[model samples]
Target: MAEHGRRRWRLVLTASPLQGHMSPMLHLATFLHSKGFSITMAHSDLNRPDPLNHPGLTFLPLRDNLSATADFAGAGQFLQTLNDNCRPHFQHHLVQIIDSQKEASASEKESIVVIHDNLMFFAGSVAADLGLPSIILRTSSASFFPAINIIPQLLEQGRFPVQGPNNQILDNEEIVSELHPIRYKDLPFLCTPIEQTLKTINMIITKKPPSAFLWNTFEFLEPTGLTHIRDHYQVPVFSVGPLHKIIPTHSTSFHKEDTSCISWLDKQAPRSVVYVSLGSLANVDEKISTEMAWGLANSNQPFLWVVRPGLVKGFEWFEFLPEDLVNQMKMRGLIVKWAPQKEVLAHSAVGGFWSHCGWNSTLESMFEGVPMLCQPFELDQKVNCRYLSDVWKIGVEIVAERGEIEDAIRKVLVGKEGEEMKQRAIEIQEKVKVAISHGGSSHNSLEAFVDYILSL
Candidate 1:
């Protein structure tokens, strides 16, 4: 409680030590901190070395003794490590952190609310043990919420065992009619029929139910999917998006380059360059990497491609790019390991996005009103692709399978249909801009959400 008898909300947000999860959650944490929430953001010391910076917010680092390779493979391995190595010890460690904080100042102590990324499955139990409210924060698409919430029902309906050879299940209209439009591939790999996987996901989702599912989206950007979630979940779903706007960084965080990319973009025509990144998490294999490199070279488009060293499977394979081809693309494009994504997307030169369909990237692209060449690798990506192409009409899917890769890229870049998609992207961008304005739905929802937290 504060001077005016206002309750100071104490919140602990824990992330899964992945860049995508950490980034947006940090944005949200900072936004809440600005609104006067007492925040303690916890990260695995192994992943995020430095503490998150925000005035009045404390950062706690936990040692995750598991092998680093666990996160590289996929979310399945990550969840298994969480269940086997992290979960058993998390509650005790969390209490210790809370106790340490409580001991520091008498006035600072209150019932701590836990906000965790989806992978932090044991948090609900941790919150329960501490007699605090827990909320699940997903940096992924909100449309997936209704589907995730109904996993048990999907399982009971015999959908799990019917997966096809390539991990896609044959589409069944009857099954699709009942649940949110989630394909077998779109579900997290951890949500498998294997007894342990099923049990862990069930345990986690059932406990938290996402505590008012918050997405990095705006209403008009994907109205149908938003409506679907509202109709299905019957719970408070907050779309506080173009998240970059709510929590804009004072400046970019540069590990490799200074702010040189913006100057390069200034010379190009508006909507001329394609911004390419598969996000920090998705590892592009050598073959696909080389193919994409070749396709970009062949298209003769001015582009900005972020090719971080370890993002491709192996270092030696990067040498496979023919010297001539590399030089040619360089003349027409800019290639770097990383860039300030929000800055780059907002630039005038950025015409489109060639994305892996991660929700963070999707929202960033939406924030800029840039159309996307949707290439969803796995998990909720397929669902995101459906929403972007079918529901929102903001972009077109570049590849459903490997064979469609080059064609999809060409279509989105130079084809007449691609031009139409660009117009749709601009239209949605305007709608999103309106939604976050002073009297907009998202603006009201954000204030309402913060007010509710303050009341708690």
Candidate 2:
């Protein structure tokens, strides 16, 4: 929406194509708009935010040149391609916008700040070339940077490939002293092939530093992470998060969110349904899906699950399940392509979240005071899962085995341990509530971020 008041400003923001990344960037834009700054969202065409969903904001789509039919490459190569294809187009469009703004009246033009996701670092260089201020929006956890920074030393110490399918490195080898509760095995860098992981990490590291780093994380949840990143980066760092709640924005979902589950949740008892969603990425095999279905059914708890198209590797939605089990699941659960996550989590019947532990999901679960069954698939998700299960003690690590999934679901939904974790979650959520209110850390940091932006 348009900025209100005399001193005006505008934010031209861009985000990675993934839903997890796009949601927070849009939330940031929405939140900043509330603070009297106009917003323009520049996005890749692959997952463009709908102009209808965001009434007052402008949507500038950059040519991603990604074929919908192209075979999917690994994360590293895919990101490299996105950057390469979008750079020249991004620069040209940015220059056009800058030149156009120069022709507008003072009130309409407003000062512009180019804010972009770390994965879209090309935007930062374009902004730098245009002599405009730029900021980095880290959509993942604050702990990510420091964890990746130590990889060189860990490699020198011969810690690479710590676990060889029969080793104990995954169990807990040398602890990362700087970011405690995270060991070598839990590093997000190892989530992909080593060469590719290094390729992506190198791309991230070599980008020019921005004026500031805005993290979608709060202080209480990652004090050490925020501390480490700020100290290491030596730039202004702001943790203004649960951004979806900060200003309560409209959805920027790349996929249409099925809201019918909310009504299904209405009939269940308070804290009775276990909501399972693996987010926009993470794919599981048929075996895992079958086991998960049996587990949710066996837990004897009503559940809601998001079975995204192609979520099962090489298969469609659980068509392979036997008719009887499918019938049982139909009796007790609701499955949608994608649920309105925040609404689902906030529902009174949702007691637990079976998640992929993506940072956005983690923060949403924590903010809603819902405990989790952690099944991190890749990237920073592993780091967040470790912190949730081992450090915060609010989540339980789960496997795809029917028995384990059943037990974990039951534990989170009804057991004493579940109660304890729920209490801690609620307690942490209370503090988080305070943090977003006036005179709190996130509130203060957000204010400082706004002030810093205005200072330019």
Least accurate 10 contiguous residues by lDDT in model 1: 249-258
Q: Show where candidate 1 strays beyond 4 Å.
A: 1-6, 52-55, 70-74, 83-111, 149-155, 160-175, 179-200, 207-211, 222-235, 250-258, 400-410
Model 2 poorest 10 in a row by lDDT? 1-10
Q: What Cα-based lDDT does every candidate model obtain?
A: 0.70, 0.84
Q: Relative to the unseen true structure, what is the C-alpha lDDT of residue 229 in candidate 2, on a scale of 0 to 100?
A: 83
Native-to-model Cα distance after best TM-score fit, residue 186 in candidate 1, in Å: 5.0
Please estimate how well model 2 matches the true structure, expressed as its whole-model Cα lDDT: 0.84
lDDT of 1 by residue, 1-456 (tens): 221153345678887766677777777887888776777777665466255345556877655676556443545556656544555555766677677775766555555678877677666667777777776666777676665665567577876545657876554323355444545545554334456556555544545355566667777555666787767656677778766677655432323443588898999888778888887667877778877887777666788888876877876235667898789888888888788888888998887898988887888788688889887776677778878887777777774343465566667767887788878888877877888889887887788877656555
Clashing pairs in 1: none
lDDT of 2 at 205: 64
Candidate that scores best on lDDT: 2
The parts of candidate 2 lying over 4 Å away from their true place are 1-8, 100-110, 163-174
What alpha-carbon RMSD in Å does predicted model 2 have with respect to the real structure?
A: 2.5
